[model samples]
Target: MNSSRRLVVAVAMSAAFALCLPFTANAGHDDNGTDPDNRSQAVKGFNLTANGTKAMNHGKSQLERSVITTSWGGGDIEVYDKDYGDNGWHGYADCTDWNALWTSCDIIRVRFNQYSYKTSSQWKSLGCHEFGHTADLGHRARSNDTDNNSCMREEIWPLYYDQHDLNAIKAGT
Candidate 1:
């Protein structure tokens, strides 16, 4: 083929490949435990105070009601509550172990900071957000949520997952 024809073909192929790729809002956030196989797994909590236990239980309940099918025991995911003392984050999730292929997580850890006092609703929101991370759900900015109601947002305003978050969890887990 002529040089110009080859260039045109290359451009066309590139565009096609790009179109075939899946789009994820939480693209780069999938590094730790964002494995799909973690769906329907069990989670446990450690070092939890009364409030911390409440938050963990709320998060676990949300996950169980969602399409993820997560249960409240068995150590697949370990949740912890401790005082971080103004670390600028309310909670976080990390994968402690991975599957053989590294595509899925064998064990995950979720932690909640007890430095600041939060309302019951806020605690639930934190729980939902951190747990959402284990199910491959990423943080959703306020701008992305038109209705302004999702636990995945950086702020702890919403106490439950919005439809979009639920949909993402369904697709991911």
Candidate 2:
């Protein structure tokens, strides 16, 4: 091809490549950031029901296996199972305290609603969802997930993080 043709082809290929690249922006809400120290998070449970305990354990395990580092001890993140009847929420996560720079969360709180009447698998899904939030992840819609397979969805489904979630976490923390 002529030099002019080659240049045009190269520019087109670069644009296409850039368009195909996955979104690398952090998926989590900007209000909370990863743990300030070493980007590792420590999770603990409090006054949890039997189901709640199981859920919390599942969440911790999943987080540990993901790109976001997590441990079973320490109180960097606190999980609680409560009976919030018909409040229209299965679970939620919040940053109770912020680091000195206000960029990361010093303490995060995760809560599960027992009134949701979820099955064991559903509880596990909830665990994964809430834990994602504590990691600064926002809710993902089913339409947004190409495979429709992510616990980060607003509803309780899937038991683990998807590649998109991992990529977002990696980019964020």
lDDT digits (tens) for residues 1-54 of candidate 1: 999999999999999999999665453233335565656778787868888888
What lDDT score is found at residue 54 in candidate 2?
A: 85
Model 2 residue runs over 4 Å out of place are: 1-25, 28-38
Model 1 — TM-score against the truth?
0.81
Residue pairs in candidate 1 whose N, alpha carbon or C atoms collide under 3 angstroms: none
Tell me the tens digit of each residue's lDDT in model 2 across 1-173.
99999999999999999999865455544224443333688888988999999889888887776676887786688888888888889997887888787656788888999986789998998898888777667778667786878888776479998877776666666
Q: Least accurate stretch of 10 residues (summed lDDT) in model 1?
A: 24-33
Q: Could you estimate the TM-score for every candidate?
A: 0.81, 0.77
* Residue 62 lDDT (model 1): 76
Model 2 RMSD vs true structure: 7.3
* C-alpha local distance difference test of each model: 0.78, 0.78
Q: Which runs of model 1 end up more than 4 angstroms from their true locations?
A: 1-33
